[model samples]
Structures are given as structure tokens and as C-alpha cells.
Target: MLIGEVARRSGVSARMLRHYESLGLVVPSGRTVGGYREYAETDIQRIFHVESLRTLGLSLRQIGQVLDDPGFAPSALIGDLIRETERRLAREQELLKRLRAVDASGPTAWEGVLRITELLRGLGSPSAARRQQAVLAAEADVPAPVLAEAALAEADPHVAGALRWALARAGEDVVAALAPGLESPDADVRRRAVQVLADLPGDEAAEALTSALADLDPQVRAHAAIALGARGSAEAVPVLVAMIIDGVNDVDAAEVLGALASDPGRADAIKRALTAELADPAAPGPARLRLVQALAELPGPIALPMLRALVSDEDRTVARTAAALAGVIETQDGV
Candidate 1:
């Protein structure tokens, strides 16, 4: 076959076939009397092979090595292709996300588009300061979902706080955007999600935080519990009590529980949960001590009796702390 016939059958353009020949990827096996390039059956097969490799994102140079070098191992090149493909996919996904965010902002003009794009770039910047500035500068123009997504992924405390504030100001619609982060495989991401959800005011945020109560991460559960407790959700009582038992942010957990106890019914429930932990045989001495301190955070009337009862307990440290707390409660009561 001549070059024209080869191009027609193999779907490689004549110009490209000539370029391939120049690179020695697939030289014609013979020549006609007029000195035009002529291809043998084997040459056509090599052209098809080069086209197949191009579909796998192989560069011309890599294809040359693959086809020409008998010693070349394809596994290494395949691995590199995989990595490059992954990176390209990640870039495309990020671009799509940015474009969606911009479109969701409902930009009315090219100026609005440019402004949102700049803000998004700032939010995604490597510098925490720039991200913080972006969040602080964000207003009603920035969509709640955008802020929520940024808040969930933020690592720096200051930047994260700003993003949460922005999300909160953006309104309760952010709950939908933030909900997925609660199920994230990364504990840190789940924690951040709950943290922002805790500050957001709405049933959606509350419901999201309520679900997070059972999160495997202790910190995530603690945050959710505290938030729920503050929102007057009795659901937080058990986890707050557990936080006391585990000595993880037990002080803050106890404070939330004490606030929850302001209601008579809730006060009784909180009292039972605390006393139950204190009475458990598996409860360690240190945990008991923490529980004793947590009990004091309750209303004086509710806590004083428990404190008085604990004063005579077997653990001397628990007794001393309880006795001291009981005395203070008694003096406050003028008993």
C-alpha cells in the first residue's frame, strides 16, 4: 500500500503519517518507482499501534521508547501515566467546582464573575492569611455552599473560624452543604463540619449535629453534644456525661450539661445520668473525680445532695473534692 492508501485504511492522516515516518515511529517498508513512500502490512500495523498508545496519554517520545526499545518496561511508564491522569482529573474537578460556585453566586455581569473568581482563588490560596481575608471579605454575594465547603476543609484555626462565621452569616442554607462533611472519612473534616454546624442556627444544623453525636471520633461527638445541649436538645446528655467519664473537655461538656439542667425535667435527667456514671463499678477513680466536679456544675440544689453523698465515698480524693464542693454549696445556700 502507498501512503494515501495507508492513511485511508489506518485512519492516520497523510500529514501525520509523514510526521510519524520522520520520527521513525513507522517508516514505510518500501518505495515505488516514482519514489513515493510505500507501506507494507507490518508498517500499517505499527501505525495502528502508535494510535492506540496515544489514546492512553502517551507522549510521542514515550511512544517512541515503547515501540523502539526492547529493554523498556511498560509498567513504570504506565504508573507515570496513571499519576498524571489522576492529577489532570483533580485539576478538572477543582475547576468544575470553582465554576459551579461562581455560577451559583448568580453573577449578573463579567465584573461579578471576576470578583467571585478572585474570592474563590483567595479562599483556596495556600496562605492562611489570604484565606482568612477572603472569608472576612466575603458577603452576601458569596454563596452559602461555597463558604460551607471552604469551612469543612479548612485546617488553620483562625481561617476556619472566619469561614464558619461567613457560613453562619450566609444563613442556614449552609447546612445542606456542610452535611456531607459529617460523614467524611477524615476525622478532622468531620470535626470541622460539626464545629460550623454547631454555630449555625436552624433545625437542619441541629439535626446534623444530632447525627454527629454517634460519630466515632470522640472530639466530633463532644462538639456535637455541646452544641446540641446548648440548643436545648436533651439528646446531648449521654454524650456530655460520657465526656465527663473520659475526661475529654469534661469542663466544657459539664458546663453545657449544667445549662441544659436549667429545665426541671432536664435537670432530673441530667442528675440521673451523672449519678449513674458515679455508681458504675467500672468507673475509674480519676473518672469518678471528674464526674464529681461535673456534678457541681449542676444547679446547687440538684448538685449539693450528690456532692454531700460523694463526700463519704471510698476514694479519698473524690471525698475531699466532693466535701469541698459540698461545703461551698452549703455556704451558698446558708445551710
Candidate 2:
């Protein structure tokens, strides 16, 4: 059985399972490729037996010797139990006296209680401390996969968020890699699901992008738009342009789509995106400015009319960006 299954079945935490193995009380049946311990049916039985002996106060060494010799005496275990009871009784008495003194004296005599309380609350118990180490080893970013292997960890928010961002930037073909995870039933698994589908290029990624665009989460849609742009899909161009046009209030989507026109082959598409915005009389000033800049990057006589008109644009930033592009195009021509 896997360690998780073993832990579930045995009512012992996985930590104790390895601890038992280390003490030579139980042996692992095998190991996973990641070196995770695997155990057999017999390992559980051995653990149950060892736990019984421990409750009866067998020292670990005593247990080991007993395992090798069926004739081992039970008197040694009885003596160990007696000693443990005496030590516990002494400590209990000491703590009880201190508790009584503190209770009778009141807060003035107990200034250290507040500090002790904070320390106790803030401190990590030894068992709880191992959780951080386990998370570090399991999280993808510590050894984050390149290309398309980024994935979420349920327990670590830092790892989950980082892995999602990495997958978001993992290039156009990354969508194909996330195909299986998109259908995953787990919510944590669902978080990084959309990035994979949206990164696929062309019309192939459009339906996925459309679905992401319609998702309830804005981040999901924003990432979808980014993936669509990365895929550089012409089909996505119109949808992306429309979204940018309607999304003037959307800073992130605007930023992602604006970056697209800066790409070489998409210059005309950016020009078209801008022209579409310019034609919309209700367009926001900021959105129009973004459109004007996108056009400028793809500067040509095709946008000369729009440029000349934008030179007199009501928004100063729009005119400024339009003028800059016309100057650059003119300068390039002169070159």
C-alpha cells in the first residue's frame, strides 16, 4: 500500500510509520520512484503489535530482542512501566504545586504568564514543523517543471499561486499539456485548468478561450485572453479585439491585448483592432488611446487617416501616442 493508504488504515500518522521503520520495528515493503515509502499488509500488522508492546512499556530495544526470541520474559516490560509511572507522578506533582501557587497569588505574581502564552501559541510543535519541510519538497516551484508541468499544491498557497503563474506563461503549446487536468474534479486542480486550454494557438484554442472568457472568475478569463494572444490566433483576434474594446475598464485584459499588437505578424490585426475601436463612437478615452498606440506600432498608410484624425483626438494621450507612431513611421520611411 502507498504511505497515505497505510496511514489511513493504521490510524497512525505517516511520520510515525517512518519512525517505526527507522527503529527496525517495521520494514517497508518497497519504495516509489520518488522514494516515497510503500508498505505491505504485514507492515500494518507489525505496527499494531509494536504499538501494543509500547503501551505495555516495552523499551524499543526490549521489543527488538523480544521479536528475535519468543522466550523473552514479560517481567522486564512490567518494571519499565513501573518506572515510567513514577517519573510521571513526580513531574505531575511538581506542575500541580506550581499551578496552585500561581492560582492563589493572582495576576500580579504571574507577569510571565502572558509571555509564556504568546510563546506557546507562536511556537511550532516538532510534529507540526515537519509539515513545512514536506510542503517544500512536494511543491512544484522548488523544482518547478519547465514547458508545461507547473501544477497546484492544495496545502501551500505560495506554491499553488506560483505554479499557476508559471503555467500561465508557459507558451502556446502548453494548452495541449493541460488537457487532462481541465477535466479534473478537484477544485485545487481546477485553478490552473484554464491556462492549458487557452495557450493552444489558432482556432483550436478559441473555443477554450471563449469558455474561459465566460468563466465566473476574472483571473481565469484574463489568463485565457493571455493564452489566446500567445497562441496568436486570428480567430481569437476579433474576440480579443472586442473584449479589449468593451474592456476599457479592464486594466489587465487591456494590458494583455495591447501587448499583442507589438508582436510582428499581428501588427495588421492590431491595426484592425484599433480601427474597430475608433469606429465605436462610445469608446472610452483610455481604450481609444490603447487602440491608437496599437495602430502606431503597426504604422502604415492604412492607418494614416486614423492617425491624422487622432492627431486632433479629444484625449491628449491619444493624440500624443498617435503622433509618436506617425513620426516613427515617417522616420522609418526616411531611413
Candidate 3:
């Protein structure tokens, strides 16, 4: 077959076939009487081999070595090709994601597009400060969904705070965007989602947070409790009480519980729960101590009786602390 026939049959352009010939990658079996290139069956087979190797991302030079060197082991080359393909795939996926984010933003002008692009770059920057600045500098044109996605993946505390702040201001759009994150199998992502959702206002955000209270991850549940407690939701009472008992962010949990207890009904409930936990003999000594400290935040009517009973207890630290709280309670009560 002639070169033209090979090009037509193999789908390799004539120019590319000529280039391959110039590079000595594929030589025709012979020449016609007119000095035209003539490709035999073996040359066509070699062309297919070159095309197959090219599909694996081999450079022309590498392809030359692969085709010429009998001792060339494809193992190392194949490994490198795999890594290069993976890197290319990653880049393509990232680009696709950015494009999707930009499309979701609905930018009407080049300026909006540029701004969103810059913000996306900043959010992905290596420097936490840049990430923070990106979030702080986010404008109305920046998509809330973009910020919501960034917040879920952010690891730096400051950057995450900034992202949450940005998302919170975006309103319910952000709440909707964050809803999927709550269902993430990753505990950290779920916790981050709850953290952001807690700061968001509206019944939608509240519903999400209320649902998060039942999250399988303890961290997610704790965050939901704190957020709901701060929002004065009585449903948070049990989790807040549990956090106090478990001594995880107990001080902050106690403070939130105290705030929730400002309502007369909640105050009574909080008092009862604390007292119940205190009276459980299976409760460790340290846990009891934490509960005692937590009770000090309650109204004197509820806490004084518990403190008085604890004052003469066998544990001297508990007795001393209880005595001191009782003294303060008595002073406040004008006793």
C-alpha cells in the first residue's frame, strides 16, 4: 500500500505520517519505481503499534525508544504513563469543578467571572491567610455554593471561620448548599457542615441543625447542640447536658445550657437533669465534679440544695468546691 492508502486506512494524517517518517519512527518497506514511499503490511502493523503506544501518552521520543529498543522494559514507562495520566485527570477534574462553580455563580460579565475565578484560586491557595482574605474579600457576585464547598474542605481554623462567615452572610442559599455536606460519610466534613449551618439563620438552617443533633458522629452532635442551645432550642438540653457530663467543651456547653435555662421551664428542666446526673453513683468522681461546677450556673433555688448536700460529701475537693459555691449562692440569695 502507498502512504496515502495507509493514511486513509489508519486514520493517521499524511502530514503526521511524513513527520513520523522524518523522525525515522516508521520507514516504508520500500519505494516505488518513481521513488514514492511504499508501505508493506509490516509497516502498517508498526504504524498501529505506534498509535497504540501514543494513546498511552508516550512522547514521540519515548515511542521511538519503545519501538527500537528490544531490551526496553515497558514497566517503568507504563508506571510513568499512569502517573502522568492521573495528574492530567486530576487537572481536568479540577478545571471541570471550577467551571461548574463558575456556571453555578451565574456571572453576567467578564468582571464577575474574573472575580469568581480569583476567589476560587484564593480558596485553594496554600496560604491560610490568602484563603481567609479570599473569603473576607468575597463579594455578592461570589457564589455561596462555592464558599459552602470551600468551608467543608477547609482545614485551617481561621480560614474555616472566614469561610463560614462568608457563607453565613449568603443566607439560605448557603443553607441549601450545605445540606449535602451533612450527609457526608466523613465525620470532619459533617462537623464542619453543622458548624456552618449553626451560624445560618432561618427555619431551614434550624431544621438542618436539629437533624444534625442525631448525627452518628459525636462531634457533629455536639456542634449541633451548641448551635441549637445558643439559639434557645430546648431540644439541645439533653445533648448539652451530655456534653457537660462527658466534659467535652463542658464550659462552653455549660454556658450555653445556662443561657437556655433563662426560660423558667427550661431552667427547671436543666436543674433536674443536672441533679439527676449528679445523683447517679456510677458517675465518675471527676464527672460529678464537672456537674457540680455546671450546676453553679443554675438559679440558687435549684443549685443551692445540690451544693448543700455536696458540701459534706466524702470527696474533699468536691466538698470544698460545693461549700464555696454554696457560700456564693447564699450571698446572692441574701441568706
Task: Count clashes in each candidate, considering only residues at least 3 apart in sequence or on different chains.
Answer: 0, 1, 0
Error of 3 at 248 (Å): 1.1
lDDT of 2 by residue, 1-335 (tens): 88889888878888987887888778888888999888877877877887787777677787777776889887877787799899999989756744543343243534544433222232222433443333333322222222233342233445444445555554444556555555555544544666545433456556656666655554565566666665554445655565555553245444555566566677676666667678677888866766675554343555556677788777788888888787787777763
Measured against the true structure, the TM-scores of the candidates, in listed sequence, are: 0.94, 0.40, 0.84
List runs of model 1 lying over 4 Å from the truth.
33-36
Which regions of candidate 3 fall more than 4 Å away from where they truly are?
Answer: 31-38, 124-130, 155-158, 183-188, 215-218, 267-269, 311-316
Clashes of 2: 1
Return the TM-score for candidate 1, rounded to 2 decimals.
0.94
Q: Which residue runs does candidate 2 get wrong by more than 4 Å?
A: 1-158, 161-191, 196-207, 246-270, 299-305, 314-317, 332-335
Candidate 3 similarity to native, TM-score: 0.84
* Winner of 1 and 3 under lDDT: 1
Candidate 2 vs 3: which has more lDDT: 3
Pick the winner on TM-score between candidates 1 and 3: 1
lDDT of candidate 3 over 43-93, digit per residue (tens): 999999999989888998999999899999999989988998899999999
Q: Which ten residues in a row have the lowest lDDT in candidate 2?
A: 138-147
